[model samples]
Target: MPVRLPGPAVTEELDRVLGDRAAPGYADLRRLPYLEMVLKESLRLYPPGPYGARETAEPLAVGEYRIPAGTVVFYPFRAIQLNPDHWPEPERFRPERFTPEQVAGRARLAWVPFGLGPRSCEGAGPAMVECRLLLAVLLKRFRFRPVPGHRVDATERFVRWAADDIRMVVTPRKAGPPPRS
Candidate 1:
């Protein structure tokens, strides 16, 4: 999605933080705030794990009706994340919506790319770090352009999958000396 919706601001920020370096260190990754926002916004639009289920431990009241104990409750994360109520321009890819102030203004549970609560995925933190590091490295190393006539759609299974093959052309970046501090 980042490739499809390239933001000049994000690119400029990446270049500023990365300088002429081909790879980003931990500190460098931290400095790319816009890139982080882009990644999070991407996740918000298309979370890898789109749905989760939990069995009710006890009788629960939901609005007017009561759900009996042991009822399997499904959490449709994708739908929740895309709800227009929580996010303005829900379908549009806008990373600026994730600025610290904007995030703090929204409901605490509005963004749950990795699920929520104590039962949330244990690897969430590490997975985010890994994704940021790998994406930063790739963005630094190449420019991605979508291939003409390729179709990309979202499909749900155990995890969200692209419905069709996503074809992109990756052009290796020219090597240059790191920018002077």
Candidate 2:
């Protein structure tokens, strides 16, 4: 199922980044480094989907083995993210891994949050902006914390989802007192 809403951490991160830069249509969301980091890390750890496939068109040598053309290949994003050769301390959630200079210097196709090549997600940019905006609005109004008896579990299907549903306590922020008229 679709998330339908942003998680609490995402919301908090956005607020921390935006601070006072509250503008409409994602103006405030892009200014946050930590928020971007969290997003990148989250995507790395748990991409929207489980895997992807491609058909090989020509004979190729993969790690000393020559496979004939026309073979179907599967790309497991989860495994790639956890590969020690590609990421250090793969299990840890570190957004700094996606720093501009760091990412630019990394191998191509290393981070495929929205897929790669010519068939990547067409809505990647807009979707990211939307996620940021949603998180910003939510963080400005409330805080989320895990409920006493519940934990978040995620499942991967066509798109990864919160397996047991995101059970959290949404405490609305107390508004400041108004000026005396």
Candidate 3:
């Protein structure tokens, strides 16, 4: 995230919301809507898993075709999030796209990094909360900058990952007490 303009803003937001506290409670996290946006945008760019499948309970119809019931449908999480029709600039990482107003204007299924429907991940809710908290705490305590000349390629497997591996430089922040474990 340090590679982009919004990345610094994200750290700024976390710092503002956290103030001088090394550890924030749930109440403090509640004020971090932009943090959530960053997470959402990150997920949109690289979801946990590459793809998910669901069996149709009833027949479904596409624009000009009908899918019979019981047919398993496969959907790529990244593809859905990157669709030009739904996302303005499919390749860019703009957390502003995840603003409440912008989200309300998109389709219900536009953002589903955790998968969707009844078969979706059960830990999705808790995972999101945990991620936000962890990110807030860590980013508040450190400045993460990408390693120079490191090229990251997305591996299209069960879970999304950098084929060359993600490398970064982490510098500890000198403000306030160390972040709570």
lDDT of each: 0.80, 0.68, 0.82
The TM-score ranking, best first, is: 1, 3, 2
TM-score of each candidate structure, all chains considered together: 0.89, 0.77, 0.88
lDDT of 3 at 109: 97
Instruction: State the lDDT of candidate 2 residue by residue for 1-181, as single tens digits.
Output: 2222334455555445544444334555556655666667778887887787777899878998887899888788788777777788887776778888878877877778777777778998888777656655666677676667676677777888787888777888643332243
Candidate 3, residues 96-132, lDDT tens digits: the string is 9988799999999988998998889999999999998
Please estimate how well model 2 matches the true structure, expressed as its whole-model Cα lDDT.
0.68
Model 2: how far residue 46 lies from native, Å? 1.3
Q: How many backbone clashes does candidate 1 have?
A: 0
lDDT of prediction 1: 0.80
Which segments of candidate 2 are over 4 A away from where they belong?
1-24, 174-181
Candidate 2, residue 73: how far the Cα is off, in Å: 0.5
RMSD versus native structure for model 3 = 4.0
What lDDT tens digits, residue by residue, belong to model 1 across residues 91-153? 888888889999998999889888888888899888888888888787777777888767788
- Positional deviation of 167 in candidate 1, in angstroms? 0.7
